[model samples]
Target: MQKNHHFSYVIGAILILAPMLAQAETKDINQTKFSKQYAGWAATIEQTESEDMLATYPASVILWAGSTFSHQYNSPRGHKFAVADASHSLRTGVAIPPGGNGKSASCWTCKTPDAPRLIKEMGEEGFSGSNFVDLGPEIKSVIYCSDCHVDGTAKLALPRPHAQNAMAKIGLPFDEQNISMQGAQTCGQCHVTYYFQPENNNKVNMPWIFGNTADAIEKYYDTRRFYEWIHPISKTPMLKARHPDFEQWSRSKHADMNVTCITCHMPTVTDKNGNDYTDHKVSGALIHFDQVCAGCHKSKAQLTATLERNKAEVDAKSRQVQNLLVKAHYEAKAAWDGGATWPMMNEGIMGIRHAQWRWDFATASHGMYAHNPKEGLALLNKAIEQVSAARDVFKQVSSQVGAAKPVYPDISTKAKAQAAIGYDEPAAVKAKQAFIKEEIDKHWHPVATTGY
Candidate 1:
């Protein structure tokens, strides 16, 4: 009797909320636009992605130029583009490592649904250290339902070992008992910032020992002295923040209300057959605010306006900090070129590195402002403050070395900026194109040409 009453109460509550949800624009929830097949490299640039993706920055800063990211970077299209993007990206060049080498298989971990199977065949460490080319032919599926769902059932599964290890570190165990966290963890599996553990076969590990906050992660990196690469111009050890969507959203207002990532991203919808199911399109919540927020929010238009206003504020601050950090890098280079001693350049180098790290942490997640406006703006302010201090150090150093003020160069365009940082853009594109013709074209069918 109690169970029946509880179920009735839930249904009645949904009925009451339906009128409130109807205030927003409606959608045909049955549609699925993205293909099940692999979307090759051309689709990422020519069709689905915006040109602005490649031009997110004014130019290639020294930190990016020193890393593989400068070779090719974009806003991710969707699950369909996973395997093809991983395989054909200029960053993951055709460098096949020898036996016992790492970083090869680590790249594919989050890009394919075949990961669990491959990891089962080879241990987590073995898979992480294996040659990427050796597993090429075996790559069959892109990210799909099996990644989070049970093989024959719709039940969710937390099969990713790396994700499990990360949660354990933060004292959140992934098991059958914690179904609510499991829903979010499925997305957290890839969305959180992580690094290749150098000593453990380059195994992917999240720096969650301290915690998930930006300060905690940065402290963990500082204590461990884990740097992604060294900037060529500033010679500062730099950190590259991978998409930290999970980290940004984990402690958000929505999360505080027990709203999981699935609640917003994969909203419930009915099929043509009148059967209801969770939509797997997996897009930003703002796109379908009616379906996601419903009774919890006002009209979609008002909510969207608020979100956009917040984003604009965050974007402005980000641009300000980015320009300052870029100047710091170039000014440090000027100090080096002018024969400044290591002691003189030390403060500026460390400042730029730390500042950039914070900036990237806040900006890397495409929807950071929407996810957590307070945290996003806080991080950008820190970046602005840090970069200003760094600029002071550079100014003092330049004077000590009898050098002129650093003149910002002609990096108005992407090509020009990358060139300024000494990255051969033409050569990278040419090589990537050749690789597609020879390797990718032969195996994968390019279905992403349409509706991309």
Candidate 2:
């Protein structure tokens, strides 16, 4: 009876180990030798194993892995190198001393992917959690092909996980399909201009809480007293123009009529051989007039003529708006100098902010003047009216106070004006030089060709 029981136990153990042993043997045989005698069989086995592994993994993971592999082996590094070099070179000229004024990690937001990674690596200790100001010249690349497209596919896609996460926070729903269609939304997150406030240090921000419109953003800025710089001659706090791609598009007829930045900028093209594909080589829409504009408009000559007319109208209107903005600043300066209190200056400041926002949004849109010429011209004209009206109000107030005519600063020459503003030129140059050296050193190391 004991012998029989032992025999049963041994048979059961063998049964359990049989599959495991077979797998081991198969792996060994497949990897053991490379000879022409077994070449065909080996190739078949290898392909089967690869397919099995792929099947085992999630589809998304497999797709991402393939993309990573392609970027490592096939993509050209020239653009990467050029972008890094240019960014580093530019940074060398804008270095500030340690703990200097106008220093913030927020400045690096659009410049490099390294800034966020470094922030994460440092955690609580690095930037005091609010230390977006301390990142120091790290970010330096524009959005690239890898940012939006998958490997081996021409489909434009979203690459940033943070954006999806952000949208999720706002209760914006997304599925794989809708997310895929909304590729421009991903690019818009950063491509849209923004200002980071020191008060809102912990969050990557946009000044759109008031809303996405020109008036709304301007109200937010005015309420917060946010100023990019103070004019050296006029001494009025100046708001610098940032690229307002999304905001401008939001108000455009294309946007109002449901067109998007991707519609015009990332339009599809057909090769001479009649192969149609989305042209991913992004630039201002004007570059591919025939392909982009003429595809929709049958008459290329008419579209060109229309664009030229729109450009002329926009230029004239922009100048008018800019002049009014300058005049408003001067008039406001006069009011303040003549003892205008905070309450008294509130309306004037609000007017300035609104006019500036409108002007900035209109001009910041590189293709707006042509995309819907009539709308663009109309918006610019409205912006001029707003600023001109505001200036007139300021002039009336200044006259009542018997204030002298306020001096307006000339910003036409970049260098002279930069120095006049007490910007630390020497420190900026030093920091930029150091950044270039660091970038050069990275090229010397054996670069890892794969993984994020």
Q: Return the top candidate by lDDT.
A: 1
Tell how far residue 282 is off in model 2, in angstroms: 1.3
Q: Write the per-residue lDDT of candidate 2 for residues 177-268, one digit (tens) a residue.
A: 35333655656656665654546453345666667656666677778887765543234455544555655665556656555666676566
Off by over 4 Å in 2: 1-102, 113-142, 150-181, 222-241, 255-259, 269-276, 286-291, 372-379, 408-452
Model 1, span 259-282: residue lDDT tens: 888888776766668866666667
**Clashes per candidate (backbone, < 3 Å):** 1, 13
lDDT of each: 0.76, 0.51
Worst 10 residues of 2 by lDDT: 66-75
What TM-score number comes out for model 2? Answer: 0.63
TM-scores for every candidate against the unseen true structure? 0.84, 0.63
